[model samples]
Target: MPSKSSARLAALTVAAVCSAASTVVIASPAHADAVRIHDIQGSTRISPYAGQQVTDVAGIVTGVRTYGSSRGFWIQDPSADADPATSEGIFVFTGSTPKVAVGDSVTVSGTVSEYVPGGTSSGNQALTEITRPTITVVSSGNAVPAATVIDARSVPNAYAPAGDPAAKGSINGLTLRPTKYALDYYESLEGMNVQVANTRVVGATDPYTELWVTVKPRENASRHGGAVYGSYASQNTGRLQIQSLGKASDFPDANVGDVLTGTTTGPLDYTQFGGYTLVARELGTLEQGGLERETTRKQRRGELAVATYNVENLDPADGTFDEHAAAIVHNLQSPDILSLEEIQDNNGTKNDGTVGADQTMSKLIDAIVAAGGPRYDWRSVDPVDGEDGGQPGGNIRNVFLFNPQRVSFTDRPGGDATTATGVTKVRGKAALTVSPGRIDPTNAAWEDSRKPLVGEFVFRGRTVFVIANHFASKGGDQSLHAQYQPPTRSSETQRHLQATAVNTFVKQILDTQKNADVVTLGDINDFEFSDTVEILEGDGALWSAIKSLPRSERYSYVYQGNSQTLDQILISPSIRRGCDFEYDSVHINAEFHDQISDHDPQVLRFHP
Candidate 1:
């Protein structure tokens, strides 16, 4: 008779198999000959013994995932082989509580399979698992294998292998080279018990009961303790994901820069959301770093404070108006001019013909006023229905809100959604033919993307051209956890073109007036060192103001384990020459899990 745990595991496995259309078909059971776990796991990403029947795979259960869709327990051979590239542990996908406790010496008969979590569409590497298992508990309370220590020195400095797509190439198909690349190092230890100690939190504690940490301080580590995000070139080599196997309440709410001290011991599991994760049974204590939320920036006389904020797809139906308004008023210090992105149409996500965001903007303005913010005037040119890429029918576009008492919109006539704004030389000064106009709305580069909204504002009797933009997002790009080394970035092609178009427009303004105060600001959706940003900063026509800050303080967003800048403010040579500008990236959002927007808003205060 099967043990109670084994029976429960079998019952759950059957139900899961019925629901999940598993790609690998189960094969007939092989003879009951003992097979080492390493032989089944192999030295590569794909198991050499995948889809083959294996019997009596002996090992001690190191960890068990009793809940979730991919329910399974990890088992590690007590005596690991000499090959460092081959993992000694493997996961048995029982799909339920496998009637095996940790430290039990078990031998099982099952079909080996390569299971891709979330299926093939996710583009993730297939995890080797033993399915349709028959378990035999040889003995109880066996000693588990010692955990492999994972720290900065243990992980390789390299990120990925060179790409070769013709043969399904590179890191995806090659044998594990644990000492050569970070991906390979993680792969070699898959399903093995591992330990991470004295690491800094890179990503905040997320809603999915997980956080990210780096074993060593990354390049340009923030004073507050977050790793500054640069380009894909700096592939955060020492970062790892942490998932608490205990109750959700037991998990700590840690922010970026906080430390995870002591030791977190767990089985390294490849997950669907993040790539390699330490599913920790025993998590270390979270040591707070005294990282407090930043307050609003201060405004000064003779200084025009301008800000750019991505509201994360705000609409009338959304309930975050109060929080967002408070952030703008109290945290941002009520700038003279504000550039807002992702403002949806009036009906919010409703797919009707309504492309106007008047209602949405009105609601936000009302909330701002209620929050003791100034009464502000707004301007924007709505995009064609369904043409702008975002939430379908949301018709998201950029808009400006200016305090009339401090700044006034320089309105000329004939500006509309389809009309491209033109630069004109007016009386020895650069001037827009129409203030608050769309720039090249019909450009192929801007197809299904937000067109730049250029507005000419008069602040303290001087003209400042502010272009609000929300560039093409980095969607459909290869994930860092992808099978390919240094994964292809197909999403950057359109952004490169978009950057060129905007740069050309800025050039036109500079050609007319060398001293023109042109400020381009919004979510560029790329890092400061990215090719897209380099195109915008071509020939020193414009300068990325964020670079003026210390390297440690340049980030406005955090993704995966990287603290990077996605929001930027680029100023013309005229503004750079004065050298009187002050910039602040208010850190109320990006570093915190309970954030209104995934991005932090940036403000530039300068005397014109």
Candidate 2:
């Protein structure tokens, strides 16, 4: 075993190598206030002291990384004769001076602020602020500790249990938390850059393929970004597929020897085969950052037409969207706001290798533009598989497309859609809150996954709080006693919980806006007569615009050849009294006059 001093030296080296690109360095006690590079042979002699001032020290640069908004670099003392091993800090000021790259030995002086999160006893100190901690170059050298190359995505499943999910996979040193289903050791790297080495299994071969690769932080990345450098290993369930870095011509061509580096644009996400995270924006990549795009538009009447449609598993090859294209031009009733469901995210085009949902929405926008409709700004909250029962690379999700001129983008979880969370409900909705005239974005609701898509809409003279819901369906199980089985209350129970949550949320909103006009619409999956609807409406306390008409004529869906009213536009009396809106139960996506969806599309028009 290495001595404590040697271990300290090794740890410092690891930190330096890991953060090779950052500009700031870890601080040492020698020149406390001055931000200088120190080359300590061993790190054990370093004391657990911080917040001190150090000045004037020279050493070798080990690694670099970006800390929060600031860039940080690491340095170490070169003398093996030192009593205790120690490392010094080197801060980079991007505002005034140029950023320091790897292998540059610079002397600096500044305050030492130790990194202590919440409640931990670690004595390690983090280097911050290079402005006061002046740094000057002493020497420069080639980048040290060359990175090992590896392809992790190509590994096949070596230890997958029968009937296990298709996404489950393991690497030589990667292990996901069984119960929590997360990367337990990676909370800090949730929205940051990370690099790791793991075995890549190709065929049924032994030892598989081993390579070191950098993983960009994504919304669905592993918590400590998936552990590396350990006796513990990863198991490939074949869910993680990568090539020998040889198949570059046909694919996007990330070379096996290519170093992976990007920013932590999203959060930690997990899947069944292995942990999967997203890189919303890559520091250096062919793909642009998700936040880089701009939304264009045109504003019309005060009333923004809001439309929610479940495009029904949009496939690139279906070509049925041409009909949808026609609808945007002629058949479709233009709305100021449109929320679509089941939009698919394509990873290099698996569907007939055509355009993706991101581009499809763009095409839809173009179609609307050709029809002289307002240019719509759209956003999709990249959903990581495993959060509230999502699938990785499966790509299907709900999206919000709106008129940028009428309603400006406001506060979102990450400037995108928000997944609703609830204790009782399951299938979630994406919530968006926009203040009239592009007001500042603030957190509008305080619910977790499985909640409703709560939207604060400003229409006419009042800010209407609208909740667009696509509730749980009573399909799947057919057994009569399934509702009472285990903790799950069958499919009926699922719909019931959705109703309850919508009711609870609507009531809360109504409490503040006594005359609040709350309209709940979409494919509710239950009929107007179902008990779920009853609980949602609260014994005639709520009113369905369709209920005001005759009973037989209220059906909007055709079930088993019978016209069942599944799609409904329910509202609070305050909203119903304001304007006369008609429910256009047209066969929009319907085939040859046949209903397109198992449920029909309902529309509501009100004066703004």
Candidate 3:
């Protein structure tokens, strides 16, 4: 099955293609004349002349996408029609290198067709294109068409169509309704020269040479900068993707909240990764955020500080080890106990049968000690060679790192990758049969996913039960920017089951010992508002500590302009009903472009 990102890209590709097809203007061969680019790209998404032959379609080549399967060039008419709904530009698909230059004025004759990316079964939109074209350069060095300004005011306040595609009219059947929906407004300007001025960075610069920006400040903007990714009801309408096609070096490294000044001019091109991207020729100046990385979290006496961090597939070969060590020591304040996720085997992405992360853990511990932190002791069950899923043979698993001077690991036997941990009553108190054990490792919910590692620790003579987890990722879910309102969360099913299993185990422990200091924390991979979190927090058995903070500060991760919580440290009710507990979502990463990990570590400091 395709991952959520892959599925979204497929869906967006289809939607863009289908939107282009809506502009076809059908005409008989006898009635065919020299067609302008705008006429070929009609007022609607699907072309009226789709699947028909056209002669002398004229425009100036503005941009060329030479890489990828969709190698093509974009053309825009200098003299455009006065219709706000009609685009003046169109993409010409040549399948290979095109015999055209950026400034060349060209005319071509070919059969108009609707091309669906990733095949028709993908249910994507069919892009209107002139395929197998015979081209003629009408002129050289003709001035390019002036770009139409598209500021926040020009974009609609709405995001998608009102109803289902069937109800709102099919992608190929609907008329252009640019005034009603942002999708329609973008569809109307598809393949057109456009410009956006004074934009604010909403997403950090990605590896794909793309970044998202908002032309206007969102109503629910984040106080720390960038737009707030709201619930299903609030779709960010002014956000747009900017892509550099001229010089890769010109693409700036920007974080969320950075500002781009001046005018960014380019032709708009719909893509699979992001919906509509401005293939920029002239870009704006990037003003740095001047955002400093966070310092060490404050530590207080008599409080046991426990933290959960997804190290993002950390291994010995990974170059971010030093930075990660610094973040843990300086930014996280060297918690007494740390639950680390995504600890790969000794050889990072090497798919060998090396399941032990001893070398990897040793290196990290060494780095931490060298970075002015205490020498830490670590313990984890080696996962079955190919059972736990992550990077192919990486054998990623959750491990515990503790300052031995401050805490002691209750080491016993019987813990392994495949065996489930058994609970026993010791002096009428809940206790793990094994010190470090896998919780229901063989359960189907954990198949092809990380199994939770439960460990017993003694901090200040008080035993604390810590279950480190890395739940099933949100791989198959629809993107927040999908055409569907309240997009489907297909990936939550497995996570829901996993959450239930963990919750049931926690309940068993609570049933035996009412005040068992339990901290189940790691990368849950679902938001605090999600059903997975709700399942884990069933009937008030567990409470997410992150919720104790202000709503504006609850996020541990940032994606596509939305500051959301994916990493959480949920405590049992016994731990929550105390007075000395304090939680913090330490801001060391996530929002910055130079992040060592995609997630920020969360810490819970309390007197247990």
How much lDDT does each candidate structure score? 0.84, 0.39, 0.80
Better of 2 and 3 by TM-score: 3
Per-residue lDDT tens digits for candidate 2, residues 1-608, read 00122333343343322222322234554544333232211122122323345566554444444432233444443432322112232233332324554567667665543222110112111223333456677767743322212123322223221221332211111232222211222221221222333221111101112111233222111111211111002221212222121222322222221322332122121111112322221122222111111112222465455555655545444455555544543544555556565555554225343223676676667767776666777755444332211222334544566666666543334233333422111123223333211111112321112223555555544555455555654433321111111112245666676677677656655654456666776666666766778888974446666666543345443221123456667777676675455444443321112223333355555653
Error of 3 at 380 (Å): 1.1
Tens-digit lDDT string for candidate 1 (1-608): 00122333443454335213544343544443577888877888887777777889988998988877777789888898999988988888886777989999998788788776545554667777888889999898877788999998989888878756775544656878899988889989998999999888989987767899998785457867877766677778888999977888899998998899999998998865678999997899999887777875578989999999999888999999999999989999899999999899998668988999999999999999999999989999978898888877789899999999899999988888889999998789999988889898899998989999999999888999999989998866667878765676778999999999999999999999888999999999988889999999899988889998887889998878788898999999888886899988889888987877888999999888
- For all predicted structures, in order, the TM-scores are 0.92, 0.41, 0.90
* RMSD to true structure for each model, in Å: 5.9, 20.8, 4.0
Q: Name the top TM-score candidate.
A: 1
Residues 109-180, model 3: lDDT tens digits: 877766654344333345567776888998888788888788777888877664355633244456667888
Ranking by TM-score: 1, 3, 2
Which has the greatest lDDT? Answer: 1
> Clash pairs of candidate 1?
5-99, 6-99, 229-563, 296-331
Model 2, CA-based lDDT: 0.39
**Candidates arranged by lDDT, highest first:** 1, 3, 2
